[model samples]
Target: MNFNEFELHEDVLNAVDSMNYQAATPIQEQAIPIILKGGDLLACAQTGTGKTAAYLIPILDKVAHEPHQHTAALILVPTRELAVQIDQQIQGLGYFVGATSIAVYGGNKGPEWDQQKKALSQGADIIIATPGRLIAHLQLGYVKFDQIKHLVLDEADRMLDMGFLGDIMKIMSFLPSPKQTLMFSATMPHKIGDLAKRILNDPQEVRLAVSRPAERIDQQFYMAGDNQKLPLLSHLLTQVSDTSMVLFTSRKNTVEPIVRALRKLGLKANGISSDSDQGEREQVLRSFKNREFPVLVATDVLSRGIDIDNLSHVVNYDVPRDPEDYVHRIGRTARAASKGTAITFINEADQKYVLKIERLFEKEVEKRTIPEELGLGSSPVFNARRSSGGGGHRDRGPRKGPSAEGQGNAGSKKPFRRKKPRSKSAAKAPSSTPTNSAS
Candidate 1:
């Protein structure tokens, strides 16, 4: 249905018109009214479904009808990128309505925080902040949430995954107990469900676009070993020349190396990770969207919020730790009813993830071989590449020789004996085990 049919305020309708947002996405159509009615909402929506605008539009409308100088609405997000993204959407949809909002997150200059606080005191109606940073502001008596009437947890799954549950509870203690709570997640994990129970009061659940990949996406996989991922990805990008693509890495540390390696191969590629500043991240995204950069490398953090129109392909350079993230990463390409391709790199470590993903999509993703140029054709499968004789990052560098599977060229006659793949339960330690923190 169209935005006009929702009986939004004239200016909101006008803002939608100016933004050229004619039809409401499934999430928007399902969520706008539920939130406008002051009901707590638990929505399951992937990225690229306009989920951000779904709640933002109604929140702005509420603020327009009853303007408040106090922080009337509080939005807690997991990362600064998402905080900025949601704030931007609020501006775009609420521009004509004159709704005032502020984003408070870590990594901002102290002066920026001071200025933002000054604006808050002068009556910023809505506040978006990361959990840790927001808690710090509250502890320092810089934030006034006593007047909060609404609360939102965007990417609830991410928040829980990032170990923000305690911080979330702490923040909730400051809000009015009677306030409306809206929780949005790409997937509803067990923890998310439990958190919703504790926070939301008999919430209305919207399962719009529930756990499904966008229909326009043609999902497939490229089978390779862990070490072969980057080389295959670089080769694939060359094969699909001129297409805008995102390469998804599971770890933040992998982004830069992948970009550097791709560039070494003379490809126009760049990377973005959590460590990247807002300016640099935005530059990479803008360049990719504008076609100045054909390939953009990122982690799961970028998978959900980034929107690039007509992005033709998604390359999963690393298997997502959570299978659900796999769907969101690929969904980036096939948006707005446009067709796109989603190619994932599945190594032995990812075999367990493959089955779960297939079940999620309810279809077997087409498995394809890596390009022969990358040496998947050598005599031995584990054909080790000639190394630079150094360790560390160089040790993990892409291999250079061909595999023995497809060719019998001058290669070692030794058989490639791959160790049996480990079972999922044994592959990873228990969730409570202390793994290194993601940067």
Candidate 2:
């Protein structure tokens, strides 16, 4: 559906046109009319489904048509990255409609706190905030929400995962009752349903299918030992052409070490984690977006809502503990129907996690053999049962080959060959159970 079919305000349509948005995404097509009609909504949409614009455009239209004295909409997100991203989108979509907004997040200096105070005490048309920072401002008793007509909890499952339920409830205490509430979550766990029951008032629900990785994403898995993984990664990177990649590690401490290793290999790379200050994190993200570097080594903090376009590849330096996160990590690539690649490095301990990921995908991801030239050692064969018990099969020992030293330019070597494509019957294995939507 086109944005025009929704009968949005003329100025709002102008802004959408300027952004070059031609048609509404599935979530946007279903959610916009409900939001414009002033009804509460509970939408199940994954990342990259245009859920931000789905909520923002209608809210901007309402703000354009109606007069308000205090802040009008409150969008609570899980991370500072997402808070900033949504605020940026609002600036683009709300431009012609003259909507004012601010992103309220933590980890900044005192000046940021003061600025947030001014916006909250007076009013911005929209306030996008992380729960912790917003709660800090609220505790000072200066923030006001009496006039907030719209309340949206985006990525509700993630916020709950990060243990923000208490803070979210406390934040809700300050808002007026009988307002429109919209909750969008990627997964529908019981806790999400429980929270929705308490907060939402007879909301219309929209559930999209569980989003699989885009067909354009070529998913590949490699079985390697912990010691051999880095050499293997260096080898693989050399095989690809100039590419934009985000390498996700589950641990923050490993981010710098991996970055240093890549840099020593003569690859331009940078690292970011929670330990990095807010300004530095923003700068790193900005530089990566501007193509200042080809690889960004980060923790799962960048996995969820940070939008970097044209990402050619995603490398899972470590498999995520949660199966759903594997989806979000690779979902960064193959965005907007574009082709991309997702590569995962699985050590012995992480083999079981791969099994869970395959269950989620409903098909086995292709596993590749390590290049013989690196010759770090014999790689562990995948055995789900043994790996599930935290044990892996014994290796035969190191194979004879050149050391990782001075082998950084392996791209000039023979290109790595992938396994042949699987048959359609094997790829389309049917599920015995029905898929359930997030409640």
Candidate 3:
């Protein structure tokens, strides 16, 4: 559907044209009219489905037309990067419409906190915030939500995974109950359903299928010894030089060392992690988006954060422990129907995860033998397979790259494998994931 179909204001139409957005995505088409009609909404859409604009455009339109001075909309996102990204979009789409906004997240300096406080106390059309940081602002007693007519929980599933459900409830208590509430998530679990029930009243649901990476993403994997993963990654980056890439590890501390190692290979790479303050993180993301650097070594901290359309490569330097994380990471690239590449390095320790991921994908990603010349010993357990890149590929010597393999279109329809029901399982996945995305 076109923006012209909606009863949007002239300023909004101008701004949308300026942004070169011609049509509404499916999520936008389905959800915007309901939201404009002042109904609560529960939308299930993945990252690349234009879900951000689905909520933002309508809210900005209403705020722009009504001309509110108080905080008109409150958006709670999962990470600082997402908050910043959404705020930037509001600024862009609302540039001519004059919609004011602020991104409230932790890890900022005192002056940053002061700025946020001023925005909340004074007035803005919208306030995009992380759940925890917004709660901190609420505790200060300066926030005025009496005029907040729109509430959005962007990436609700991720917030639940991050254990911010309580903070969200606390923040919601400050808002009036009669306002329109919108819940958007990439996935719909029981928790999300429960939260939606508690928050939205007679909500309309726009449920899209789970999103997979772009079909153009040429996925490949390498079976490397633990010590040889770095060497293989370095070699693969060399082959795919001249395009932007995001390299994901499961740990934060390992981000820098891998970045340094990549730099030694004459690659422009930067690292971003949760430990970095707001200022540092923003700078890193800015440079990466500007193409000042061609590579960024990061953790799942950026899974939902880095939404660069031109990002052409994603390297799973460390196989993610959670299969959903793998989906979010690779989805960073191959966006907007663009072609890209996804590479994974599977050491013995992470091989089990590879099987699980393939199971989720419902098709096996071909396992490739690491070139013997590089001397990274094969996983003692993994039997080497024939090269599938074909042709004189075997004779490329030092330039021999990793394996190419993939399954499914974007994501899978089959349910993820479940463990047999057991009492007192005695083990659970860690939530903090400090190392899950870092190393």
Q: After superposition, how far is residue 5 of candidate 2 from its true place, in Å?
A: 0.6
Per-candidate TM-scores read 0.82, 0.88, 0.85
Cα deviation in Å at residue 97, candidate 2? 0.9
For every candidate structure, what is the RMSD over all alpha carbons to the true structure, in angstroms?
13.5, 11.7, 13.0
Candidate 1, 370-417: lDDT as tens digits? 666555442112111221121113123223322222111100011112
Instruction: Tell me the spans in candidate 3 whose CA falls farther than 4 Å from its real position.
Output: 383-439
The better candidate by lDDT, 2 or 3, is 2
Off by over 4 Å in 1: 238-241, 371-375, 378-439
The candidate with the higher TM-score, 1 or 2, is 2
Largest lDDT belongs to which candidate? 2
C-alpha lDDT of all candidate models, in order: 0.70, 0.79, 0.74
Model 1 scores a C-alpha lDDT of: 0.70
The TM-score of candidate 1 is 0.82
Which pairs clash (backbone N, Cα, C closer than 3 Å) in model 1? 377-403, 378-402, 378-403, 378-404, 379-403, 379-404, 380-404
Q: Which digits, one per residue and each the tens of the lDDT, describe model 2 over residues 105-168? A: 9898877878788888888788999999999889899888888999999989999999999999
